[model samples]
Target chain A: MCGIAGRILNAPGRVGNDLVELMDAQEHRGADSTGFAVYGIPRDSGYILRGMGFNKARLDSDLEEFRLLLKEHGSDFLEDPTFVTSDAAHYCARMVISDPKDLAGWVKDADTISDSFEVQSCGRSLEIVKDTGGAVEVADKHGVRDMIGTHGLGHARLATESSVLPNASHPFWARPFSDVAIVHNGQITNYFTWRDRLHRLGYRFLTENDSELIAVWVSHEMSQGLTMEQALKLSIKQIDGVFTYMIARQDGIGFAKDRYAMKPLVVVWQDGEFAAATEEQAVRRIYPGESEVINYDGPSITEIWGVGNRRAAA
Target chain B: MSEIVIDVGQRPIREINEEIQTACKTAKPIVVRNTLSRHNLGIGLPPGVDITFEGSVGYYCAGLNTGATVTVEKNAGWAVAEGMSDGFVTVGGYAGMSCGAAMIGGLIHVKGNSGPRCGVAMKGGNIVVEGKIGYQSGFMSHAGKIIALGGAGESCADALWQGEVWVAGEIDSLGVDVNVVEPTAEEVAEVDAILDPLGLVDTSRNWRKMISGQRLWYFESRDANAWLMI
Candidate 1:
């Protein structure tokens, strides 16, 4: 089991504190790892590179090699990268690349450098920070409470089926697809079948985690001209699992559940703002007063909200 | 009649819950204000205490209650009065999923609609929902009485085992191994007893009682359809 929390503000605002508190509230569901995929203002001509390392020593050297690779690819850093140690086993780094279009190639190259070096997220407006720890510890180490974004999603993973490594953490980026991330609760039964299919279609997978399959599949569908809502609807029929998953993109945030509706997801909306989580307790921490909370009935239920707008489709 | 008031917005939830537990030891009347959808409020309370929550609550409110009377002024999230052995829980507004789930004793009442799986795995006790209920109400029920005044959604009383379900409105469909049976005089009296205390008496609507057909427990070679039903 895992905890998934997400928020969409009608206007662009700092959502870091809210996301942190949300993950904290649902911390009981998963304590193995925690992460966030936050969408902020876009830079004019750069991409934010967030990565995780096995440790501080490895992270420092990995950052150096990453810089050399950027220079080798004719890319320059917008500024000096910042690195922070989350724990003895994990560290996080963030840097801005001068060439935004080269992010995919840069990530592919970076992954080949070392098995321990993993790019968490890279996009114009999206940044992902994840590591093995409690939600509060991860937030404090990464300064998640101070992050500013219009919409975002957070995850706390319990590591039911995989190793408790940084690469196995949630809020997985749809690699090669910019500004898209997903957090999911529940397991996918047909993960191997779908993974093989996507792999046959030229999709490269970095981790063996089943949740990563969702990101790749959704990104693949979107590349084929399907909207996020359409892709999610189609996925409900395709993916065989009792799952509830949330996705955040540059334009909007959305969530859907499997046909069995075995997982729980509660949503609350008031004053053009929306918050959803595995339980209502996390949502209540955001809007603690008179806002009404509604249970999202599953069996192929989907809801979406565009950033800085009240255009919600259910 | 002394009343202890707790403002949850001002005080931490753990502290407030501790105070309630302490108060209930002495059978004190406690009033909690500004609940604001916090979870685990009024859970596992002892007997003979009265508690009132002025606002909404999150998951597992008044769960595992043993003889206390808890009242919510507004809506309640998931699992209200779950696993309760005895007590009375009243929700003024809607309730979320698994309300009165696995309850063994006591009574739970919802004034508005209740989400899915109402009275699921109920061993005993009585549950009454005034408004509509979501799908799979009374799923896997062992024994008890459930009354839905506003009707039930899909698959009402699925896999019911010896429990009594009385619905006043239309049912979307009956679940597996369940059948609508004629309400006997004793059954009608039980429903009347459960509803009379709320000052609600409705004779205009027709009521149906649902129970499980015990044919699925045994395999009979002579009856071919019995194998399919099980």
Candidate 2:
């Protein structure tokens, strides 16, 4: 079992603490790994690189190697990367770099230096911090409670079909698609079939986690000129699974469940903000007000909260 | 019966729940006041106790109740009275989704609007909604009775398996394999017994009853259209 939570605020402010609190409420859902995709203030021409390590020592060495690789590839760092201890067994760092047209290629090349080193996310406004631990502890380690953003997505992963590794953690970033991330609860029955199709289309996958395919598939559809609402509506007919998933992009955050409504998802909208989670307890903790919380069920129930003028499709 | 009034706004949820549990051990009446949308209130209570929330509550209020009588004076969040077995829960105001979901044996009364999947997957229970309910009110239910007095949303009783549904108002649509059946005089009397206490009786309106057709339960090799029915 896994827990997925997301929050979208009408105004730009600090929401990392809200996400951490939300994740802590559903910590029982997952204990193996926890992570979050936070959308902070956007930059014009730089990429935010977030990498994970198995330990502090290895993370320091990997960061050194990553810096050397960036220098070797004629890429200039806009700011020095800062490394921090995420947990007893995990570490992470954030770096801002000048525009590299082949950012995906750069990330793939950086992974070859050490198996313990993995790029969690690379985007203009999104930074993913995740590791193996309790969701609250990991969030505290990454200082997620202090992050300010417009919207974000988080996951508490209980490893069932995969190993307990950072690479297998959720809130998977849709690679090569800036500012796209997804957190899903439920299994994808047709994972390999869809993965193979995307792989044949020259889309690369870093992890074998089935939830990552949702991000890839949705990103593919959005790239094909479909709106986020349209892409999610299409997923209901295509993706075969008993799933409830939430997506966060540069523009908005939205959630969709399978037609069967097999998985549990409760949403609360209050004061122009929306909070969704695998359970209503998590949402109540975030917005402890008198908002009417709705149990999301039925066929193709989609809700989207856009940043500005973008209205919800459902 | 001694009354213990605890203000939920001033105390933690855990403390309030523990106090309620302690009160239930002695079969005392507990009144929880200032419950400003706090989740998980009145959960896992013992039998023969009466607990009342003076204000609105958050999710899972009175969930998993065995035999306690829980009353919320205001609106409730999602999953109100979920998984309840042998108890009575009354919502004085609106109720969120999945009200009385998967109940084994109990009675859940919602005096106002109930959100979607009101009696979903109920094993054995009786739920009465005084106001209109959201879509898919009794989806995938097995062996229970759902009475919606005002009306129900689209696909009112989808995938019903041996359960019974009676709606007095409009049904936007019906789910797959669910069929409306004429209610007998005995069945109408049974419904009257359930709603008479709530001061809501609509004998003039055509009360529709629905049941599962059981078309999706079996497979026939000779039947060509059986696969498409599901």
DockQ-based class of model 2: acceptable
Question: Candidate 1 chain A vs. true chain A: TM-score?
Answer: 0.92
As for model 1, its CA RMSD to the true structure in angstroms is 3.8
Query: How accurate locally, in lDDT, is each candidate?
Result: 0.83, 0.81
The sequence of per-residue lDDT tens digits that candidate 2 reaches over residues B185-207 is 99999888877876777679689
TM-score of 2: 0.86
Off by over 4 Å in 1: A55-76, A86-90, A100-114, A309-314, B9-15, B25-28, B170-174, B182-186, B215-230
Worst 10 residues of 2 chain B by lDDT: B221-230
After TM-score superposition, what is the CA distance of residue A189 in candidate 1 from its true location, in Å? Answer: 2.6
lDDT of candidate 1 over B1-230, digit per residue (tens): 78888878736778988988987777668999888688889889988889999988878999999999999999888889999999999999988888999999999999998887889999999999998777778888898988999998877887778887789888887777788998987778779888999876687768899998776556577765643412
